[model samples]
Target: MDGQEGKATRKGPGAPRRNWRLYGVTAVGLAVVCGVAAAVGQVVRAGEASAVEAPKYAVGSGGGTKLDLPVRPTVPVTLTVYEDPRSPQSRAFAQRYAATFSHLLASGQLQINYRLVTQSDKQYGGSGAKEAAAAAACAEDQGRFAQFMDQVWQHQPAPANDALKDRNLLTGLAKKAGKINHDAFTLCVDRGQRNGWVAQSQSEFAAAGLGEAPVVQINGRPLPVPPAQLTPAELTSLVSDEAQRVATAATP
Candidate 1:
């Protein structure tokens, strides 16, 4: 279409075009099935896995040096998300039910873990996904991992693989988070300092033999839901019910 058409097309000549807002709104329902899929061809090519010595350390996954909320329930229920920043399913899930996770985190009822997977680089043919993972880890070091991640998902780049690979935009997001020191965050990202840690985190996820991104696990077991069909209320109810269940079980 011509510029006078008053439209911004993500596609070029001869490519099928669609409305960006409608596409984004409709794409909000994408979901990834939770399971250890047997597809094992993908690998993290960014950096070598270094040792993680923190008693509780991870990027967004609970515990360690990662991005974990301060939820200290005794005998806590765990929610680990093996996710990728560029995964459409993860974006969709965030678009719809991120508030539910936020509510759960506030209640301190579950130990949430975000295990990042950069295999989308292999699946999508670029290093953007992998670099995004590292950038997120840098945010973790700056104490904005949780806030920064919510913002990332909330305002993810369109066409996940390509636009999100920009290093400047990724670091700029940290600056936008406000809590993170922009200088440190910038240096961390620019120097690719956390790439090794990000690689190690992804390595752990791969070694666990998990499937694709947006893999949800509760108590170290897969928790599958039809992301397209799930409602926020239902998810919050599920969290409440799980909290009660854990409390009851721990009483004995």
Candidate 2:
């Protein structure tokens, strides 16, 4: 169903499961930074350099962009999320959890790995989901993915409108994101540099056999209740309980 209301559509079939492994509940060292698209020159990380023509984001053994607060210390939880920019549910989920996300991230109790899904592109007959996801990846290059996505939801057209492929609209939103390199953003969006990365993300989503968009997993498992149906307090309790459990296990 991919969590789009009013329609029952199956996800794509027979996609290869990108190699997926579960991270233990132990403290995470650091979040993965997404590599720049080929259009941009090589990026050096910690004195190591690699060249790949395609846009490469830090992905899990499964899939998703690993995002976390820069100031956070070692923590015991990671939230694995799947979303489609074009999906109304995904937007609502983002809005609904914005504060909770801040609290969790600041507390160093959680980090998020976001997987952008494009199932709606197949069901709704447009490339908006894929394009938007790629564009967001481009924003990731500038360390503005979260801000760029906020603009995306704020300006998202109707599902059937299929307006995301418009470079003007996308570039305009990049401008709204503040401090982003307007020329680079426009070039990345226009050239579809991250399209391959977006496609691989979607493939990994499908291969997991997940049924819908707006999926939230705690420590590699879905919440006991559907994320949309959960209150912030409930979510906090859930994460707190897990953190406590992990602490208990680590006690000498």
Candidate that would win on lDDT: 2
Residue 56 in model 1: lDDT: 59
TM-score of each: 0.64, 0.70
C-alpha RMSD by candidate, in order: 34.1, 32.9
Clash counts for all predictions: 11, 1
lDDT of 1 by residue, 1-252 (tens): 587454444345324344666666666634222122222212232222354444353335544465554545664878877778877788787667676887887877766888888877778787777788888888988778877777678667664447667877887677677788888888888899988887897788788877777777777766657555668787667667777887888785
lDDT of each: 0.72, 0.82
Evaluated at residue 189, the lDDT of candidate 1 is 86
* Candidate that would win on TM-score: 2
